[model samples]
Target: MKRYDPALYAILALIFALSCAYVPLAGRGGGEMTIEVVRDGKTEFRAPLGDVPEMLEFRGPEGYNAISSVEGVRMVSADCPGGDCIRAGTIKNAGESIICLPHRLTVKLTKESASEMDAVSY
Candidate 1:
């Protein structure tokens, strides 16, 4: 007959409890998202995730640039010489970002809290 160690049981219980606490947060990532556009180190525009896809245009020292977002965000167009931002592609996750150095622009996606979503919907 094998005996179970109390210390091992306690560790397993603790891990189970921690995993339970983490599941809800882990599942919250696909919640509503907001778009933040920063230019020249300042936030230039903020908007809710759009249902219809569209491009947002901006003019900077480097020239014109466009950012687009629907369920996912991307740099659709830019006048920068290398056009690296345009190639950065789509980002759908919170904390993901795309930067255009020539234009000093940044586009970031962020998850919205349940309370904030409720307020917006109502």
Candidate 2:
């Protein structure tokens, strides 16, 4: 039998701990979702997806883009070619997005967790 190296085991354990530390625990419940509007590669506006319906307008490079949200989020009006953004009906979940290439604009839904994890462990 070969002898076990203490240093190797210690390193393996540390790696495992660090890897699991960032894993979000399940059953934490759903978080609030928000719509982030990006223009010119920068976030220009953000709004919460709540009960009351809302309409937002943002000035893009070419013109203006209008977004509406009630139960979910959607781009209601825009001058972008094909009006694809308007076709992206509604998104209620995290990681969903809508983009308009002509206007160089993007709308995304992001979940804001109550207990957010840190990027690094010190």
Per-model root-mean-square deviation over C-alphas:
11.2, 10.2
- The segments of candidate 2 whose C-alpha lies over 4 angstroms from its true place after superposition are 1-30, 51-53, 113-122
Per-candidate total of colliding backbone pairs: 0, 0
The number of residue pairs in model 1 that clash at the backbone is 0
User: What lDDT is obtained when candidate 1 is compared to the true structure?
Assistant: 0.78
**Tens-place lDDT digits, model 1, residues 28-55:** 5556677888988899888777643487
Q: How far is candidate 2 from the true structure (C-alpha RMSD, Å)?
A: 10.2
lDDT of 2 by residue, 1-122 (tens): 55898899999999998878657654455677777888878989876667435888888558878887866788889987788888878887787788888898989887766454434233
As a whole number from 0 to 100, the lDDT of residue 116 in candidate 1 is: 32
